[model samples]
Target: METPIDRIKLSQTAKDQLLKLRRNTKIDQWNILCRWAFCRSLAEPTSPSPVPIPQDSNVEMTWRVFGGEMSDIFLLALKQRCYNDGFPTDKETLATQFRLHLHRGIGYLAGDPNIKKIEDLVELATKKI
Candidate 1:
């Protein structure tokens, strides 16, 4: 499956949040944390806000790195989300939605007071959506 985005660049605010998450969860790899964040956003019932997210931070990763072994699954999930939200599956729309969901998830994870360790992340993942 082809992904709409080739490269992923995060906002400065997201970078700071991920830094904190790393210190708290001890998950050093950006891609792993990103996968968690992306899924976290996907689990939400509401659509992500459409506000523009500035990619001013230096943190960057290829789509391959971000999705790792589950690239196709992530792409399918994004496509499914777009379908569920009554959005077009065009590259532009997919790309925009991907960014929104990713950033929103990061914010959710960072803001959650319960996410202080890796086990907390696991608990969250195991919870019913």
Candidate 2:
């Protein structure tokens, strides 16, 4: 089993932007984008695939594709922190902390706002291909 679709997929706006770029450049758009992309999974893995998290039982999946997981690490850290804290009050400080974690979480919530400065860099790396 996979996590719920919690993040955003590439938006139509981004597609429009890409279309504009392709038109302006008068080029085969996919060619340029493909060169820089690093795809994670084009579909769900087969029966013997590594579990995304240890909590999940062995399972097989079948899907066409999904977004990258740049933010997963940071989100995990945030989860760890939250679990350790035993559900602290939802304060601004806590928000800030989570924000920091999300920054590093690559598109952690798919189109979610990045918490760290690095997200922008990653965004550029994946931008829209």
lDDT of each: 0.96, 0.32
What TM-score should be assigned to candidate 2? 0.21
> Per-residue CA lDDT of candidate 1, range 1-129, in tens?
788999999999999999999999999999899999999999999999899999999999999999989999999999999999999999999999999999999999999999999999999999875
Q: Give residue 4's error in model 2 in angstroms.
A: 16
Residue 69 error, candidate 1, Å:
0.8
Displacement of residue 14 (Cα, Å) in model 1 is 0.3
lDDT of 2 by residue, 38-120 (tens): 12111112111222222122221211122234334433433456556554534443434332332222122223333223344
Could you tell me the lDDT of residue 70 within candidate 2?
35
How does residue 69 of candidate 1 score in lDDT?
92
Model 2 residue 37 lDDT score: 22
Model 1, position 49: C-alpha lDDT score? 89
Candidate with maximal TM-score: 1
Q: Where's the lowest-lDDT run of ten residues in candidate 1?
A: 120-129
* Reference-based lDDT, residue 19, model 2: 47
